[model samples]
Target chain A: MLNIKNLHVKLEDEDKQILKGVDLTVPAGEVHAIMGPNGSGKSTLSYVLSGRDGYEVTEGEASLYDHDLLDMEPEERAAAGLFLAFQYPVEIPGVGNLTFLRTAVNAQRKARGEEELSSGEFLKLVREKAKTLQIDAEMLKRPVNVGFSGGEKKRNEILQMAMLEPKMCILDETDSGLDVDAMRLVAEGVNALRSPERSFLVITHYQRLLDHIKPDVVHIMSNGRIIKTGGPELALEVEKNGYGDLLAEVG
Target chain B: MADTAVLAAQTVAAKARPAGTALAARLAELDLPTGGFTRAARADAAARLEAMGLPGARDEYWRYTDPAPFNAPTADALAYTDRESTLFGGIDRLKLVFVDGRFDASASDALEGEGLEITTLAAADAAGDHWAADLYGKLEASGQKPVKRPFAVLNTLAAVDGVLIRVTGKVSRPVHVMYRRVALDADVTVHHVVRLEEGSELTLLETGGIGARSNVAMEVELGREARFHHIASKRADDAKVGIGHVFARVGEGALFKSFTLSVNGSMMRNEGVIEIVGDDAVAHIAAAVLGDGGEGRFHHDDTVFITHAAERCESRQVYKKVLKNGAHGIFQGKILVKPGAQKTDGYQISQGLLLDEGSQFLAKPELEIYADDVKCSHGSTTGALDETAMFYLRSRGVPKEQAVVLLVLSFLADALDEIEDDRLRGDILTRLDEWLTSRASA
Candidate 1:
């Protein structure tokens, strides 16, 4: 469902490169986890896929379901069923969380030429989805991510994912700042939404998240390139040992 | 100090002989009602206005916004209110309507209700011994020492239609005064006075433009343990120029809260002066202004002065301005603590959102404290929209215009929070949304 080939990305405001000749792909009905050390350009890969600004894609080919993703804006990508759960969800004061979710859901629906949900329908859907993430009514009423705990923020991200129901989901460091119990809950939310029509590209530095949300394939990235690709057992090997052994082998 | 007081008294006394100006001449020529206490007050105020004349560009206070519109001949009435946006919908309240600056008695509801009494100013020549007589111009006169506000005096002198409301008990419903200009070239002036007795409460709401060139004043007095809430909205048309002044005083243990919303107008100047005269009094004055640049470069100004004269009193001034294109906004807020006014708590904040490169905001926040034990803080800020927040919203599939509107409303949420009534606050917010929507299209 997602494809990337020889992606060369550079910082727009600087002369430095972030992703150099990187390539990876994850088909439908599968979860791919990319393991990398700090400064290995894992986060940059996720950002470029989501169409974030300030990254100059000098040369690349990225697509979703045979559509040219690199040619679309961020919102256009979202309308085309691409969702990115931010590692640090922004705190937006004065914008009610439920209201924001409803706007987003209806906005995508309208963009897709589908019928928009009424207020009543939206509220019911949000409540039902929030129940699974332990998000109370009060949380839905407050400003988005304002005064939210770390785990609660992650759970909110999952709730948005469920409501939007994007075909291609990119979880950028979803395990960051999450405890064991919180990680388990998030993984459960992700696992429940997994189906043949949906795919996930989970980026993380640790194997703990992969333990909960099991990936079908594992890739190790270093020096701006995906240097190794293997089965899920590669993640366990990296967990037992560190990326040091894998990097040495690649060298 | 004595020299200053003598000079002020002499100036007030010298108002008997007037200086020359076209505005003063026109005011003098009006066939005004005469031979009463109100008449005497009007004459004295007219003299003061004549002495001050119309402020010009050289005046320090009028440097930012030109008062030429206020000085020129009255403008022809605008036909813009046709199918204009409405406010206070679905709310049952006492409604008063005025047409072309005259009280449309047939269109207005009754003037008397439980615990509230209202009398028309046109009938003041016939009425006797009213309670509003003593406090009508008192606060306005008291606020004249440090800064000069001849506009209030001009409004007092020239206004032909208004009301005096007295509340003795808790008012069940608010009173809304609606102004509609049907006549072309209508130069309207109105002076409203409100007095809330001890332990009483009242809510007053005003909407619509008074005239093309309007001078208006409102005097409010809160007695011991009383509460008064006031909200006025000026959605002036493009060619309109209005100068409005409000003078208020709070008594012992009383609360007075007011908010002003301005959506349009080529030139609109709103001045408010409030004094907390008794211990434990609480007062908050807030405003939200939106200016869409017009041919005249849309100018809006808010000048506010709040004084804590008694021990343990608290006051807050919050003002927010949203300007687009070449719109100009100015804010001048001051908080003063009198001697021996210990434990005074005063907070003032003024913020401006300059939506484009040409839009400009000017703010001057001041605080004067004579009491050593007082706590006073004031701040002012002007900035563009947060780019990060904008991107965050846009990435969520919201259109760029809708995202900007959301951010704008979020910026105004705090000022709107000062409104105590939920339904009224919501109505104003809806009006703000409509204004933003229209401006976005423009």
Candidate 2:
């Protein structure tokens, strides 16, 4: 469902390349976990795929279901079934969470030539989804991510991903700064949304999250390029051996 | 035949009087005592206004707001007439009506609440009970030229009959004063004095009615431990114009709050002067001006004086304006502290949101202090709605107009939240929504 061939991304107006000639692909019905140390360009790849501002694709062709992903706007990419769970979500004051979610869902729906959801229908769906994520109905009425705890913010991101039901989901450090219980809840939420046609790219620094949402393939990234690819056992190897050996091997 | 001649002569005499002379004549007829005071005080106040004159476009304080209309030669002289009654949309509260420069007893309702005394300054002056007189015209000579606004001068020179409200100790019920302007093409001016005694609490809601043109000035005195909540809403006819000034003195351990909402007017100016004179006193002044079309050419000037005469006084001023069409809005606020006024806290903020390209706004917030142990801060912001926020909402399937309305309403909700009265807040919000809806349709 997703493919990246020798992806080369660089910071705008700079000589340094963050993602240098990296290759990866995730087929339908698979979850791929990418683990690496700091400065491994994990976030840059997500940003480049999500079409965020100020990230230039120096030389790469990223395709999501045969459509060029880098050419679309952020909202267009979102409508094209691309969802990025931000590590630090932006706090939008005075914008209700339900309102934001409804907007996102409707945008994608409208782009797909589907009927827009009325307020009543939207509220009903939101309530049902919120219940599943342990998010109270009252929290949906508050400003998006405003005054939300660290755990609640992560859960809220997951809730949005579930509502949109995107085909390609990128979780950027979803387990960072989360407690054990919150991590379990997040993993459960993500697991419930898995399907045969859907794919996910889970980015993390620790292998603990992989225990709940086990990935089909584990890849170690060092200095932008994928160094090694293996099965779930690769995560345990990184957890015990650290990235020092992986960096030496990649170089 | 003799009666006809006498009537004709009276008419000729009234016509021959100079512009604003009728108001001056009426002032002379009211047998009210000049509150016994030093001549120097009154002279000083008169000198300051004379020096300042009517603020024109050249004055920095009145640059964006022009007060020249009040001084125009085409303005009609003040005259009383028996006109149809004005309605306040069925508010069942105390009402005080003023026509031209005098009180209209036939238009006023009776006050029946305990711990409340509502009467004319003329009657109080006749009985030698001069509480209102002593407090009246005192702010003019307070040596603060900034507070000596041109409208206050006009009210001082032409005021005839004024309303005096006295809330006795520990009263809870509110006093509602309705200032109705009925004269068209004529200059009508009024002066009002309100006193809240020690340990008393009162809410005063003043509404300005439709008229040709009017000028009003009021002085409020709060006693020790007293609390005053004032709400003023003014809606004028499209052709009508007005200038209003309110001066308040808050005593030690007292709390004073004023909320002004100006929705409709061709040209209007609301000047507020609040003084915290005693220790532990609090003064909160907030205003919202919503203007649309070419009619809403409104300006507000809020001047706050925190003397810190005792210690630990607090003062706050907040002003928000929403401008549409070719309408213009202005907000000028100042916070002042005297020497040795320790532990004083003063905050002032003025913000405006322009809805259209033709709409304009000017905000100026200033702070002047002599004490070092005081906390004083002032900030002002004027800008259009965020285009990014608008597009974000639009991309979500919300209509463009509805998105703009929601953003504008949210911008104003912060100010409206400060209003403690739910009914009043609801009324204002409804009016605002209606105005925004109509504008969208137009």
- Per residue, candidate 1 scores C-alpha lDDT tens digits across B291-340 of 88854558899999998899999999999999987999999899989899
Best by TM-score: 1
Q: Cα lDDT for residue A170, model 1?
A: 92
Query: What are the per-residue Cα lDDT tens digits for candidate 1 across A1-251?
Result: 99999999999999989899988888998999999999999989988887778899999899999679889877778888888888988888778898889988998899889999999999999999999988999999998899999999999999999999999999989999999999999999999999999999999988899989999999999989999999989999999899999999989
**Clash pairs (backbone) in predicted model 1:** B77-B185
- Candidate 1 Cα outliers beyond 4 Å, as residue runs: A236-241, A248-251, B1-35, B126-128, B236-239, B294-296
lDDT of each: 0.83, 0.72
Cα lDDT tens digits, model 2, B1-442, are 3233223323333543455443333333322223222122233333444455555677666666665676563454323344332323444566666655567788777755677877775555445445565676686445245444665754554454577888886655556666555555545556678898998887777765534666677788899999988887765342256777778888999998888877766677777777778889998888877777654344444443434455789887878888777777777777778887789988888888888788777776777888889998888888898765664444333445656666777677656765777776777667666667667644
Supply DockQ values for each candidate: 0.62, 0.14
